[model samples]
Target chain A: MDNIAGHKSGLSWVTNISVVVLVVLWLIPTVGLFVSSFRERDQISVSGWWQAPFSVELTYRTRGDGEVRPVDGGYVMEGNIFDTGEVRSSFEGGASTVSAFGDRGVAPAEYPAGTVAEIGDGETLQVNADGTYIYTSVEEPGNRGPRVYFEAETPPQFTLDNYRNVLTADGMDRAFINTLTVTIPATVIPILIAAFAAYALAWMDFPGRGLLIALVVGLLVVPLQLALVPMLNLHQRLGIGQSFLGIWLAHTGFGLPLAVYLLRNYMVGLPRDIIESAKVDGATDFQLFVKIILPLSFPALAAFAIFQFLWTWNDLLVAKVFLPSDDASKVMTVKIADDLLGSRGGDWGILATAAFVSIAVPLVVFFTMQRFLVRGLLAGSVK
Target chain B: MAPRAGFVSLKGFYMPVIVQGLLTIVIGVGGCIGYFYLSNLLLDKVIFPAKGENAGRNINRANQIRPWLFLFPAIFALGLYLVYPVVGSFWRSLYGRSPSDWVGFDNYVQLAASNEFQQAFFNNLLWVIVVPAMATFLGLLVAQLTDKLSWGNIAKSLIFMPMAISFVGASLIWKFVYANDADIGLINAIRASLGFGNPIDVMQIPFWNNFFLMVILIWIQTGFAMVILSAALRGIPEETIEAAILDGANPWQLFFRIKVPQIMGTIVVVWTTITILVLKVFDIVYTMTGGNFGTEILPSYMMDFMFRDDGRATAVAFIIMIVVLPVMIWNIVQARKEMR
Candidate 1:
C-alpha cells in the first residue's frame, strides 16, 4: 500500500514521532515506581525520583560540643561536623563533603566551605571541605556550644534494604506465599472443570447445549460484586468461610464463565472430520476427549491457562472478601492494600518495594507467555 | 497446625505456608482428576454395563448419561457459586440487618435518601462515561500510529505492560505520581518549577479529583484496548484500504471513512468490555482515597457496609447487578449473533 501511495511516505515521520510520544507516556508511571523502589528512604522524601542519579545538597543543624580550650585571646571548640552524632544519624550515605556553612540558621549556606566568616559578637566560624570545623569566641561558650549550620553534597545512594524490610518485617514474605497458595489451585482447578464442560459442549450431542452456551456467555458479564454477600453467607453456613479453601472455591466460580467461554469457542472450531473419524473408530467419549481433543486443543488450553493465571494472581477483591484476614493467610494484594496503604502511606520506599514485589510474578508470567495471553484475549472477546 | 509448626522447626529450610500451598495444589488437582475418571468409569461399568444381552441399550444409555458426567462438577460449581448468589443477593436485600426480619424495600429507600449514595452513583456515572472513551480512543490512536512502524511489536508490548500490574499496585504507583509533596510528586514538581507556590493535594479537589483517579485506570487499560483493537485493525480487508487510496482519500479520510467504519463492531466490543471493567473498579478508589473526598464508587461503597449491615451491602450489590444487566444482555446478544 505504501508503494502505491505517495503521501504515506511523506507522513512517515509523523507516525514515528507519535508512537515515540505514546510509548513514553505509557512507560512513565511504572518506571517511576520501579526507580523509587531502589532509593533510600530519606532520598525518596527529599528529591524526586527523576533526580535520583544526581547529587543532592541538604542542610543540617548541629552544635559543636567538644571540650573548649583557652586559646590566644579566645576560646575554641574544634571537631569534625560529619562525626557528630546528629550528622551521622541524619545523613544517608558514608561520604559527604561540606559545601557551605554559617553560624545562623537563617543563612545556613552563607559562606562556602574552606573559608572563615566573622560574627558581630567577636566570634568566628570555619568549616573545611573535609567536614572539620573550628569555632572561636572571645567569651567562654555555654555547655550547649555554638550552633553550626552546614550544607553538604551527598552522592547518589541506592539500597536493597527496602525490599528486605518489607519482605521480612512487614509480612510481605508471608503474603507472597499465601498469594501463591490461593492462585495455584484457583488457576488449576478452573482449567480442569472448564475443560471437561467445554468438551461436552463442543463434541457431545446433548440437549440444551445452545442454551447452555448462551447462558455461559450471559454469565460472563455478571459482576462479581453480586456474589460477595451471598457467597460469604453460604460459605459461613457451609463452614468454609474465610479460609484458603473458601477463596479458592470463590475464585473458581468467578473464573468459570470466561474459562468455559474461551475454551468452548476454541473447541467448536476444531476439525470436525477428525472428531468424526475418531468416533467411527470406536473411541468412547471420555477416551476421545483425553486422547484426541485435549491434545489437539493445547494452544487454546495454554491460552486459557495464561488468562486464568494472570487473573487469579492479580486478584485483590476475591482474596480480600473470601480469605481470612489473619496475618497467616493474607495475600500480597490484600496486604499491600490494607496494611501498607494504611500505615505506610507516606513510606514510599516500602510501598514501592512492596508493590513491585507483588507485581513481579504476574509481569514475568505475562511477558513469557504473552503470545498465549494475546491469543486468549482475541479468542475470548473478538468474535 | 502444631504438627506443621513442629515440622517447620525440624526442617529449618521448609516454611509451613509453602508446604501447605504445595499440598493444596497436589490434592486439588488430584481430586478433580480422580473424580472425573472414577465417575466416568462407574457410569460405563456399573450403572450401564456394556457386555450383556442388553449391551446396545446399555451403551446407548451410558452415552446419554456421559455428557452430564463431564459437566456435573462444572454445573455444580457454577450453580453454587454464580447462579445461587444472584438470587440469594436479591433475597437478602429484601430483609433487614437480621436475616429473619422482613424489611422489604427499606434498604433501597434509605439508600435513595442518602447523600453518599447519590454522590457515589454520580461518580460511577462519570467513570462509565469517561474511562472507556479515553482508553479506547488512545488505544486506537496508538494502534494506528504504531501499525506501520518497524518496532511496532515492542511498542505494543510496552503499552500493554500495565495489564500485568494489579490495581492495588497501579494505585500505589499513581499515588507517588500524585503525592502532595512537591519534591516527591511528579505533577507537583513540574508545577513548582513553573512557579506554583504551594503543592496541592490532587485527591482532595472534590469533583475534579475523580478524573485524576480515572487516569490511573485509563493508563492500565489502554494496553488491553490496544491489543484487542490492533487485532481488529489487522483483520480489516486490505482491498477496502487500497480502493480508498486509489479514490484519492487523504490519510485522515482513509482512517475515518475507510477503516473505522469497517472495524466499528470491534470498537464497540472493546468499548463495552472496558465499560464493564470500569463499573467493577474498586481497588483503585479504595486504596487511593478509601472513597474519601467524594471519590466513592459503587463497589467501594458496598464494601463499607459489608460487615456492619448485610442488608445494605446486598442492596448496593443488587444495584450494581441492575446496572450491569443491560451490558450482560448486550454481550449475550452479540455472542449469539456471532454464533449464527
Candidate 2:
C-alpha cells in the first residue's frame, strides 16, 4: 500500500535519471547518422557530428589560379582561399572569417588575421577575415600561383546534396520503386490466401487440421537460407528466374506461416454464436467468411500486413537470391548494402542518406500502426 | 552483368516499371479474387447442387471439401517454397556440380575438414549463445526500470526504433559509430577527444569483433524483448506483489524473487525468439565486414559458397537448418501447449 501513492522517494529521481540515460544511449547512433547526412563530405570528415554547430577550423592549401596582377607598387597575386567552390560549400551560413594565415608549410596559421607578415625574400602575405588573401613580392612572382595557406573559422553547414547524390547518382530511386513493386504484391496476396486458409482452419471440421497447424508451427522457424540455391535453381528451370514475379512469390511463401498462424488464432477466438447463426441461416462458408469473418478480423489482418510489409521491405537476401542484378530490379536494401556502402564506405554523406531512405518507409508504417504491431507480436509470440 | 541464359526476355516491351508493377498486382489480386469466387460458385451452384432434394447430403459434402478448397493455394505455396526447398537442398547436397554425379556426404566431409567452416561454426556458436542472453537480459532490465516512469513509453520507443531499421541500415549506422577515422565516428571521436591518439578498428579485432557485430542485433532485438516482457510483467497478478510488499521485501528482492519467476515463461519465449534471429544473422556481418576479420557466421559463409560450390553450399545451409531444428521443435511444442 505504501508503494501505491507517489511518495516522492529518491528512487523516483533515480528512475528518471536512468530513463534519460537510456533514451540518450539509444538515440545517439541514429541521431548521429541523421546529422551526418546533412553535412558536406569534407565537414563530416573533419569533425564529429556532435561538434557540428560550433565553429569548425578548416585548413586549406589553395593556389591562386589566375595570373599575378600589379595593383599598386609590387606585383601581387590575389585570390580567396575558398575560391575552389568545394571549400565554399563547407561554410554553410556565410563565408567564414580567417583566424590566421601563414606563408610557409611549417606554420599554416603563423600570422594572425588582419596582420601583415614580412618574409625573408621581401614577400609579404596579408589575409583578411573573409579568406581573401594579398601577397606582394618585390620581384615578379612566377607564372605559377603561390600556395596560400590559411586556417579559417567556418560556420556549420548542412545540405541536401547527399540525398540528391544517392537518389540520382547512386540509383536509389530505381531501388525504391523496385522495393515497392516487390513489397505491394507480396503483402497483398498473402493476406487473401492466408485469410481464406485461416477461415477454413478456424471454423471448418477437417481431418488432419491439428497436424497441419503443428506443421505450420514447425515451419515458422524454417530458415529461408536453405531455400536460396534450390529455389533459385527451381526458378531457373521454371523460367521465372530473377524476375519481380519470382521475388513476390518467394516473399509470399516465406511470410505465409506466420500470417496463417496469426489470422487463424484471431479468427478462432471470434464469438462462436455469430458463425453458428450464419450457418443456421444456410449461409455457405464462403458467404460467412466474406460477410462476417473478414470484416471482424481486420485487426489481425492489419497486424499480419505490417509484419509482412516490414519483413519483405527490409529483406536483402531474398531479393539478392531471387531477383536479377539489373539496374531496373535492385531493391533499396540490396543497392544500399552491395553498391553504395560496399564501395563508398568512407562517404558518410551518401551512406547516411541512403540508410535513412531505406529505413524511412518501415518506420512510418511502424509508428502509424504500432498498436496492431504490438498486438500481433503478443498474439503471435505469447500464448 | 552477365546476361542470364535460358530466361525469357521481357525487355523488348517498353512499358514503364510502375505500369508493369501495377499490372502484376492487378493480375495477381484479380486472379486470387477470381479463383475464390468461381470455386465457391461452382461448389454451391454446379458441383454439389445445393437446391436439390438431397440438399443436406450435398451441403455436407461441400462443407467437407470446403476447407481443402480454401487451403489448396496456401498448401501449394508452402510446399513449393518452404518444404520443397528443404527437400531440394538435401537432394542438392548429395549431388555434384551438375547433379548427375553423386557426392554423398563428400561435401559434408570436406566442410567438416575446412578451416573457414570451423571459424564460421565457432563464431556462429558464439552469436547463438551470447546474443539471446545479452538482449534478453538488457530487455528485462530496461523493462523493469522504465515500467513506472512518466516518460517510459517515449523511452521505450527510442530504444525500439532500431527494430524498424534493416540489418543493412543498422550495419551502416554502427559502422559509422565504429568508423576507423577519429574525426567522423562517435567512438573514436570520443577517444581522440580524451587524448587517445590511435583509433581502434573495432571490426578488425578477432573474436571480440563477433561480439561487436552482435551488439547491433542485440540493440534491435532488445526492444522486441522489452515490449513483450513489459506486457508480461504487467500481466503479473497484483496480489503477489502486494503480498511481497507486506512481507517487507526490498526492491531487488521484489523483482528477482516475485516478478521474474512469474514471467519466466515469457522470458523463455523471448530468448528462443532471439535465438532464432541470431542463428539467421547474416546481413550485418555481410555488410559490415563481408566475413572478413573473423566475423563470419553460418549464413554469410553459406552465401560465399553459394554460386561457387553447390554441394558445399547446400551442406552449409543444411548445417544451419540442423542447428535451427531443435529450437524450432521446442518453439512448436511450447506453442502447441499454449493452444490447449
Candidate 3:
C-alpha cells in the first residue's frame, strides 16, 4: 500500500504529526486527574496539576513569641517562624525558606528575606531565608507578640494520604467489595446461561430458532431504562427487593441479550465437519456442548466475559436502582456519584483518588485483554 | 451467621461481603452446571433409556425435547427480566402511583405538557445526532490516519483507554478540566494565560453546555468507533485500492471516493450503535450537572420522577423505547439479510 503512493513523503509526515496530536488530546484529561490524585490538598486547590513538579510559593502568617530579653540597649525576641506549628503544618514537604517578610497582612512581602527594616519608635525587624527573625524595640514587646508574615517557597510533594483517606474513612473499601460482589456473579452467570442457549440455537433443529435469533437482535438495542420500574416491582413481589441477590439477577437478565447474541454468532461460524465428526462418535447434544463446543468457543467466551465484567463493574444506574441504598451495600460507582460528588465536589484530591480507584481494575483488564475485546467488538457489531 | 460474624470480627467490615461474593459465585456457577448436567442425565437414564425395549423411539423423543432443555434457563431469565418488563412498563404506565388508581393516558398527557420533559427530549435529540456523528467521524479519521503508521497499535490503545473508565469517573475527570476556577480548570487556566479577564462556568452556558457534555461521550466512544472502523478499513480489498490509485485518484479522492464507500456498512453500524448509547446516557448528566442549566437528557429526566412518580417514569421509558424501535427494526432486518 505504501509503495503504491511512493512519492508522497509529505503526506507521511502529516500522518505522523496528526496521530501525535490526536493521541495527546485523548490522553491529557486522564493524565491530569491521575497527577492531581497524588498532590496535597492545598496544592491542588492553589495551582493547576500541570505545575505539580515545581515548587509552589505561598504566603503565611505567624506570631514571633520567643522570650523577650534585654539586648543592645533594648528588648528582643528571637525564634524561627518556620518552627511555629501553623507554618510547619502549612508547608507539605521538607525544608521551606522564607522569601520575604512583613509585619502587616496587606503588605506581607514588603521586605526581602535577610534584610532589615526600620519601624516607628526606633524598632528594627530582620528576617532571614532560614526563617529566623530578630525583633528589637526600645520598649519591651507587648503581651501578644508581633505578628510576622512571610512568603515561603516549599519543595514539590506527593503523598498517598488522599488514597488512604478515601479508602478508610470515605467507605470506598466497602463499596469496592460490594462492586465485586455484584459483578462476579453477574458476569459469570450470564456466560453459562447464554452458552447453552447459543448452542441450542446454532446446532439443534429447533422450531423457532430463526425468530428467536431475531428477537435477541432486537432486544440488544432495547434500553434497560424500561426495565427499571417493572423490574423493581417484580423483585419486590419475589421478596428479593434491594438485595445483592436482586441486583445480580437484574444484571444477569440485562446482560443476556449481548451474551446470547455474541456467543451464538461465534458458534454459528464453527466448522461443521468438526461437530459432525463428534456426532458420529456417539456424542449427545449435551456432551457435544460441554466437551466440544464450549472448549472451542474460548475466545468468544473470554470476549463476552470481559464485556459483562466491565459493564457490571462500571455501571451506576443499575446498581443505584437494584441494590440496597445502605452504606454497606453501595457499589463504587454509586458511592462516588451520590456521596463523593455531592459532598466532596470541590475536593479534587479525594474525588480524583476515588475515581482512579474505581477505574483502575477495568483499565488493567482492558489493557491485558484488549486483543480479545477488539475481536469481540468486531464480531458482535461488524458481522 | 456465626461464620460471618467471626469473619467480620477477624478481618473488619469488608470480610463478610467478600465471603458472600465467593459463596454466590460458587453456588451460582455450580448450580447452573449441576442443572444442565442433571436434567440431561435424567432424560437419558430414567425416562428414555438408550438400552433394550423401546430404545429407538425413546431416543427420538429425547432428541425432540433436548433443545428446549438447553434453552429453558436462558428463556426463563430473558422472559422475566426483559420480555416481561417491556410489557409490564407499558401496562403500569396507564395507572397512577397505585394499581387501583386508574388514569389512562394521564401520565403521557402530563409528560407532553411538562417543560422539563420537552427540554430533555430535545436535548436527547441533540445528543443522538451530535455524539454519533462526531465520534464516528473522529474515529474514522484516526483509523485512517493511523492505518499505515508504525506505532498505530499503541496510538489506538491510548485512544481506546477511556472505554474502560466508568461514566462517573470520566465525568469527574472532565469536571476538573472544565472547572469554574481559573487556577484549577485546565480550560480556564489556558484562558487565563491568554489574557482572559474572568473565568466562566463552562457547564452553565445555556445552549452550548450540551455540547460540552457530548464531548465527554465522544471522547469515550471514538475508540470503539476507531477499533471497529479500523478493522473494516483493513478488510477493504487491496486490488480495489490499487486500481483507484492507478486511476489517478488523489489522496482525498482515494479516501472518500474509494475507501469510505467500501466500509459504509460498518460506518453505519458504528453510528447506530453509538446512537443507541447516547439515547440511554444518564450518568454523565446525572453526575456532572444533575440536569441543571438545560443539559437534561431523557434518561436523567426520567430518574427525577422515579419513585416519586412511577407513572411518569414508565411513561418516559416507553417514549425512549418508541424512539429506539425504528433503529431496532433496522438492526434486525440487516442481521436477517446477512444470515441469508
Candidate whose DockQ is highest: 3
- Cα deviation in Å at residue A152, candidate 2? 0.8
How do the residues A1-74 of candidate 1 rate in per-residue lDDT, one tens digit apiece? 76566776668888888898889988888889999999988788889999999988888898887778999998
The residue pairs in collision within model 3 are none
DockQ of each: 0.57, 0.57, 0.60
Expressed as tens digits, the lDDT of each residue in A1-383 for candidate 3 is 55576646889999999999999999999999999999989888888999999988888888877788888788988888887656767653556889999988999999999998886687888899988889889887777667888988867789899999999999899889889888998999999999999999889996888899998999999899999999998887777777787888899999999999999999999999999999999999888999999999999999999999999999999998988777878899999999999988889999999999999999999999999999899889935
lDDT per residue for candidate 3 within B166-218, as digits (tens), equals 99999999988999987679999999999998999999999999999999999
lDDT string for model 2 (A54-170, tens) is 768878776666558886667887777677444555555567778887878889999898888886678887888877777788888887666667888767888899999988788
TM-score of each: 0.94, 0.94, 0.96
Among all windows of ten consecutive residues in candidate 2 chain A, which has the lowest summed lDDT?
A1-10
Query: Model 1 reproduces what portion of true contacts?
Result: 0.69
Over 4 Å off, model 1: A61-69, A85-95, A102-124, A137-147, B1-14
Better of 1 and 3 by TM-score: 3
Provide a comma-separated list of chain B TM-scores, one per candidate: 0.95, 0.94, 0.96
lDDT value for model 1: 0.87
Proportion of native contacts kept per candidate: 0.69, 0.65, 0.72
